[model samples]
Target: MTKEFLLECERKLAKSYVCTALGRDDDSIAITKEIAKDIAFEVTNSIHPISMETAPYVVAALRTLANGIEKEMNPLDKEIARALQELMGRFQFVKEEVKVDL
Candidate 1:
C-alpha cells in the first residue's frame, strides 16, 4: 500500500540525486535500494521521529505536500495533481459510532 509509494519515491530520488550527501551516502546514487530508501524515509517524515516503521508519517507528509501543491499557485501540475487527488480521495476516514444522552 503506502510502502509502494515510498519505494517509488526512493527510486525517483535515486535517479534524480546527482550529487548529495546524507549519512554514509554521497555523490551520485547509482545504487537505488538502501541509500535512496533511507533518504525517502528520513526526508518524507514530518511529525514522527525518523525510523524504519514510519510509513504512516511518510504517507501523511506526502499527502500534506500534495495538498499544498494542488492548492498553491493554481497548480502548475494539473495532471499529476489530479492523479494524486483521485488516488487519495478513494480512501475516506471512518468515524466511530457513538451514543450520547443529553
Candidate 2:
C-alpha cells in the first residue's frame, strides 16, 4: 500500500500501545479509540493514486503487542483485555478494508 496509508495504519495501531499500558476503565478505552480513529482518518486521507502490494503490518504487530500486554497487564484487569480486544477488532477491520482495496 501507499506509504501514507501504511503510516496512518501504524499511527492508529500505536494507540493500542497507549491503551494497553493504561489502567483498566471505559475512559481509557474511549480515549484510545478516539485517538486511533482520528489517526486512521488522517492516514487514509494522505493516500494517493498508487498501486500497493504489501499489506499493512501495523495491526498485526499491535495484535501481538496487545497479546503480550494482556498477559502482563494484570490478569485481574479484565477491562484492559476487553479494551484491547475492541481495539484489535477495529484494527483488523481496517486492515481488511485496506487489503480489499489493494
TM-score on alpha carbons, each prediction: 0.27, 0.31
Candidate with maximal TM-score: 2
Model 1: what TM-score?
0.27
Per-residue accuracy of model 1 over 4-97 as CA lDDT, tens digit each: 7677666766654544444435334345344434444454343344344555666688789757766764555676456544554544443333
User: Clashes per prediction?
Assistant: 0, 0
Whole-model lDDT values for every prediction: 0.52, 0.57
> On a 0 to 100 scale, what is the lDDT of residue 88 in model 1?
48
Off by over 4 Å in 1: 1-52, 83-102
Candidate 1 backbone collisions, by pair: none
lDDT of candidate model 1 versus the reference: 0.52
